[model samples]
Each structure stands twice: as structure tokens, then as C-alpha cells.
Target: MHTDLWNTCLHLYARPGVERACLNLQSQGLDVCLLLCAAWLEQRGVRCDDARLKQLSDCAEPWQREVVQPLRHLRTQWREASAHDEALGALRGQIKALELEAERTVLRRLESLTQSWPSDQSQGDCDWLQRMASLAGQPDCGALQTLRAAINRA
Candidate 1:
């Protein structure tokens, strides 16, 4: 398994069905970066608790709202127009890259936030994925299942 959250996300997202599942979950109003971080924390055996959950959410929400979401919205808004205009298409690609970089920045922030947290001390009930998914209002989503299965395989 990848040691870092960014690499883990890249690996997991490339796995069969993972991209689609993640996108589906995103459509349902879940933060894909947060979900990936949850999976990484779970894999690392990090103990989950209310406070940690809040910390992660707090750290991610602002960045997602202020940085990532705006870039994504701009890229998405340009999609149709870009298809018919070469200049717009190039600009959209640039925006897409910026969006990805913004996500990477958030992932780095999350990793740094948890850098001092001990892993492999989690109790059986400390499931970060479940907690995050439930918090995002998708406790029983099939997309969540797909993520779970993918992480398990890893």
C-alpha cells in the first residue's frame, strides 16, 4: 500500500471502478479528497474519534470551498464552450490542472495535520470510512461499498 495519502489516492482511484465510485460519491455531495483521506487513515490503523473527525472536516471544508470548488466550477462551466473553442479548451485544461494541484495541497495539509497521530491503535469500531461516509449522508451507498472493497484489496 502507498505510504502517503496522495499516492494512495492516485493508486486507489486508478483501480477498477474506483474512479466511477468516487465520482458518484462526489455527485452525492461528498468530498472525494476527504473520503480518500479517511481510507488512508483507516489503512494506517489510525484511531477515529469525534474530535479527529471534526478536525479533518474543518481542515478540508474551507480549502474545498475556497480553492478546489471554484476551480472545478470554472472548469465544468467551460466544458461545453471549450469543446467548440480551442482557446477555451486550453484554458479549461489549465483550470483542470490547477484544480488537481489544489486537491494535492489539501491532501498535504491533511497529512500534515495527522503526522503526529499514532496509528495501529484503532479499536475495531474505529472506522474512519464509515464515520466519514455517514457524516456525508451516504452511509449505505454502493459507491461507498466500492471504495471499501477497493481499500480492502489494497
Candidate 2:
């Protein structure tokens, strides 16, 4: 729920190449939830590296690596790849698929985060859910609506 975590998740999930992002997050000892969140963040074009790590709400990286330097090598290749529309589209599709997975993961985690809250924080509950919804990219309002219905039932 930390902004850094939220922002990181938003970017990680949205990044163009999710498997690498996921692998990096995993190597950092982040839980699947956080991995899902990072994947979400990357999907949104927010890069997470040592420079940005300190800003994360969850700023604990168990396995530190100076590997961003090498990983960035993909940028040139990606630029060259732009010439091939079919390959680019396929890669984008893969990114979309990873984002969808992270979205579903976020949705599943919502209930637990909600239930574990103290009643005194009721005023902020909806706002938190909205943020989660936004991070999930639920523009069709489907996931938000489902979450609302689920909470109502409880």
C-alpha cells in the first residue's frame, strides 16, 4: 500500500518485457504479491532499479545486483525491433498477458488487505480500494464493481 510499492507495482506489471521484470523482482526476494505489483508497475513504463528502489515503500532487496547496466542492453535491440510490426505486436501481446496476470493477482489480494484492516480506518478504505483499482487498470469498471459487490456481501 505504500506509494513506492504502489507505483512500483503499477510500473512493473505494465513493463514491455515482464518475464525479466518478474525474474528480477523474484531475485530480490519479493513475494509473489509484490512481484505481481512490480510487474504491474513495469507494465506502465515505470522502471524499478537501484536508483528508484529507495523510494519504494517496500525497500528491502535481499539480493542486490548491479545488473541494470547490462539489462538496459535490450533497449537498442528493442529499438531495432520497431521495424518489424509483427514481432513488436507479439511482444506487446505478451506484455498484456503478463499485465492481466498481475491484475488478477491484485484482485485476489484485495480481500485480505480489506479484512485485515482495523475498523478505525474505515474512512480510508474506499480510497485504498480505488487506488488498487486504478493500479489494476480496471477501466471497464469490471474489477472495481466485482470488488464492491464482494465487499458488500461481507
Candidate 3:
């Protein structure tokens, strides 16, 4: 079995600058987990299309917008308070954990979406980064540069 998309994203995001890059992209409304799964699938030569893009969007957005982002935003809002209030810090920590879990749930959905794609290594040279960047509506230079650098490193 291939390494799961969640594990792949976790590993890749740990690479220097990747976490920052992902956060930068995420702040701009791009779904980093879905992008990582797209990279994973494209690496395996899987194809992408509108329907697939919609599926990826459908898979990633609700949880991100509804669950993860709210938890994250609330946690971020507490950052300063957390410094002064141990109780606030603890609550933020728990919310942070829940946010992480919500993200992991999205990653799992992305992984499941790509699992049935045909395994053909030659087909993977797709411009997934460009596709994602374009899909994001506003092209963020830092985020695109980060993804491009990461993909080239592969």
C-alpha cells in the first residue's frame, strides 16, 4: 500500500518553510490538504478534471470552513490571552487539537477521493500546482513559490 495522503502531507509540511507556506495558502482560502493530495495523485500520474476538482473542493471546503477554520480562528484570537491566562491557554490547546483533527478528517476524504485512480507513473506530470493556484482565485506569490519549490524537490 502507498503511504497515505495524510502522512504524506504531514511529512511534506514538516519540511522547512512548508508549514508557513501552507498557512499562507490556507489564509488565502486554498485548501492545503487537498493540494497535497492533488500533488500526491499527480505524482502517481492520476489525471484531474472539473468533476474531480469539484470533488476535491466538495471534499475539503465544508469541514475547513465550518469546523477547522472556526476552531483555528478562535485559537488564534486567544493567542495573546493565552499568554496571560493559563486557562485560556489550555482551552486554546484543546481547540487546536480539535482543529488538527478536523484537518485530518479532510485529508482522509482527499485520500479516499484519489484511491481509485489508475496507477500510472507516467501520467503524473500534470501541472497540479498551477491548477490549484489558478483555482484559488488570487495567486499568492509566496504560496505558489512554496508549492513549486516543494514539488521540484520531489
Candidate 4:
């Protein structure tokens, strides 16, 4: 298993079906970075509790809203016009890169937040992904399961 959340996400995302599943979840208004963090915490055996969940949400939501979303909105807005405009396409690509970096920043922040939490101490009932999914909205169970299975495989 990857030792860091970023690498874990990289590995999981490269796995078959994981990217699609994540996109599906994202379409349901879930933050993929936050979900990825949930998978990491679950794998690390960190106990999932209300306080921890709130901490994760608190750390992720603001940056995602204020930083990542704007870049994404701009990038998506340019997708069609960028197809025909070379300079716009280049700028759009840069925005995409910024968006990715913003996500990485949030992932790193999440990792730092949980760095002191002990592993292998989670109670048997801890299900970070399910809990996070439920909080986000009614995300597809199959998508959540795909992420869960990928994490388990890793």
C-alpha cells in the first residue's frame, strides 16, 4: 500500500474503473479529493468518527470551493472555445494544471491533518467511504464500492 495519500490516489486512479467511478461520484456533487482522503484514512485504519469527519470536511470544503472550483469552472467554460482558439487552449491547459495542483494541495493538507492519528486502531464498524458518501449525497453505491474495492486491492 502507498504510504502517502497522493501516491495512493495516483495508484488507485490508474486502476481500471476507478477513474470512471470517481467521475460518477463527482457528478453526484462529491469532492473526489475528499473521497480519496476517506479511502486513505480507511486504509490506514484510522477510526472514523463524527469529529474526524468534520475535521476532514472543514479542511477540504473551503479550499475546494474557493480555489479548485473556480479553476475548474474556467477550464470547463473554455473547453469548446479553446478547441478553436490556440491561445485559449493553452490558457485552459494551464488552468487545468492549476486545478490539479489545487487538488494536490488539499490532499496534502488532509494528510497533514491525519498524520498523528494512529493506524490499526479503528473499530470494526469504521466505514469512511460510506459515511463520507452519505454525507455528500446519494452517490451511487457501485461507485463507492468500486473505490472501496480498489483501496482493498492496494
Across 35-95, the per-residue lDDT of candidate 4 in tens digits comes to 9999898888888999999999999999999999999889999999999999999999999
Query: How do the predictions measure up, each by TM-score?
Result: 0.96, 0.27, 0.90, 0.96
lDDT of 2 at 69: 21
C-alpha lDDT of all candidate models, in order:
0.91, 0.39, 0.79, 0.92
Error of 1 at 47 (Å): 0.4
Candidate 3 lDDT, tens digit per residue, 18-137?
A: 888888887888788777887777666777677878888888888888998889889999999899999999999999999889989998888887788777666555676668667879
Instruction: Give the alpha carbon lDDT tens digit for every residue of 57-111 in model 1.
Output: 9999999999999999999999999999999999999999999999999999999
lDDT of 1: 0.91
Worst 10 residues of 3 by lDDT: 121-130
| lDDT, model 3, position 146 | 85
Pick by lDDT: 1 or 4, better one: 4
Give the lDDT ranking, best first.
4, 1, 3, 2
Q: 37 in model 4: Cα distance from truth in Å?
A: 0.5
Could you give the C-alpha RMSD of every candidate to the true structure, in order shown? 1.2, 13.2, 1.9, 1.0
TM-score of 4: 0.96
